[model samples]
Target: MKKILVPFCLFLVTLAYSQDDLLKSLDSTQTEESYSTATFKALQLVTLQTTKMPAKKEFYFVVSHRFGTVKDGFDSFFGLDNATTKLGGIYGVTDWLAVSLSRHTLNKMYETGLKYRVARQNDNFPLDIVGYSVADINTFLEKDQYPGLEFKHRMTYVQQVLLSRKISEKFSLELVPSFIHKNLYNPDIERDNQFSFGGGGRYKITKRLSVNLEYMHNFDKPDFYKNPLSVGLDVETGGHVFQLIFTNSQSMSESGYLTNASGDWGKGDFFFGFNLYRVF
Candidate 1:
């Protein structure tokens, strides 16, 4: 609730100022501040969410895959032999909000999320702020393996604030502050509640292609679990976006990558992945 207040207030303020006021006593006409467009070409940059929302009534289908660690060399076929996939759909309920549902192969997780535009970058406004929240259920746990397993043990949730700025025609940057909660977790390996900060950006090298990079730091991560780092190339086609990515994490879900990334970049332990999105 604390996080929702500020953005909701800002949204009202921005919406108010963006219109022409009737109290034009001094000036004959008022200039309306229009919202910025295309700050980002996609809703996601690498592994972090961006301040982009689908247009009202628009719908999209998303397919994402993350391969196993490449450090195993030919034995594991450079991560190609072992892969995890996610299939999802996103629909814009209004210009300011969208809803999504997805299923992931890892732990057989089912996810549902909301993304909303709280504020936009317009004349005199320097930032685009958006909110994202999701809840997931890990269905892979077996009661036989853990006799005490319960329904509540499978739940996890994530909330994030996505802040972004389009600095120029060729570059855009984003910062994400995230919060995660898990009902069941190993105390020794990770915390039930975790916080992480993510930084990512995109630089257009050509009209149809751009380079993207993202890194996330967990404030409470244990020593052995490594932070995730990712780099990718974004390819824009007529009605779709294809992203080719390289990263030190195999799980694409928010809580999965943020807290459970096991691969180490130093040891060449990372996966090759791709995201394909089609909008209609």
Candidate 2:
């Protein structure tokens, strides 16, 4: 009886020790880091910038269109008869960086740009920050059309710092501080350098639908140009996003739309537009 009791006691002790060791091992396992994601689905929220980039090795083909002003009241098919279009492609060099090239029909302009994610929003960070820069060349102007126009006169440059935060699963907000430089300008009426600030937001309505709004205030706008304001809806499918927009801006490039928009919303001068993005 003593021999059997001694062996049973040893077995119970060993079993209890093994169970303790197993619990400690489980407790020591690492937990995943929590982070905020999808602050903005697409790169641009209407005319304002968003801190979004494609995944590494991915490519995005985008087509954008802005019809004539709605003030035409069916004379121009309520801004459908006349249109300005842009076609662009964005390629992701890495998870945090992307490059894009686009052409606009309004001024026969070509633009190239780079977007870099400076920082990401996470449990420890409050904002997602991005840097953007672009160069545009206007090719529509003829020597005869604008006398004394040199190659340098056709160049425009834009720099922007975009900051955004996802306050909730359904709401996000962004602010953009931008500077635009035109190599040539009307000395008497226009300044060579322009500054603008933009604000935009997104509110998700359904699983795959959202409302977006954007507005920019230019500090050095000409008398004829009104500040650009746009509102749009975004619909997401599996691999494509379609945006339906109403905007007072005609130009698609940052410099073109920010500093050169000529429509007035109060006068019913806004136009209908759409942007389509397909990813590959």
Best model per TM-score: 1
Q: Which residue pairs collide in model 2, if any?
A: none
Model 2 agreement with the true structure over 1-280: per-residue lDDT tens digits: 3454476458545744554344454345333345578888877798776998899999999999999998988699998899999999999999889999999999899999999998666654466789999999999889997889899999999999898889999999998878899997888877898988778999999989999999888888888888889999999989998999998887888998899888889988888999999999
Tell me each candidate's TM-score.
0.88, 0.87
Give the per-residue lDDT digits (tens) of candidate 1, residues 1-280: 3465477559757855665542352234324336577778987898787898999999999999999889888998998899999999999999899999999999999999999987677654567889999999999999998799998999999999998889999999998878999999889887898888778999999999999999988887899888888999999999999999998889988889988888888878889999999999
**Candidate number achieving the greatest lDDT relative to the actual structure:** 1
lDDT of 1 at 53: 93
After superposing all C-alphas onto the true structure, candidate 1 shows an RMSD in angstroms of 5.0
Report per-prediction Cα RMSD to one decimal. 5.0, 17.0
Candidate 1 wrongly placed segments (more than 4 Å): 1-33
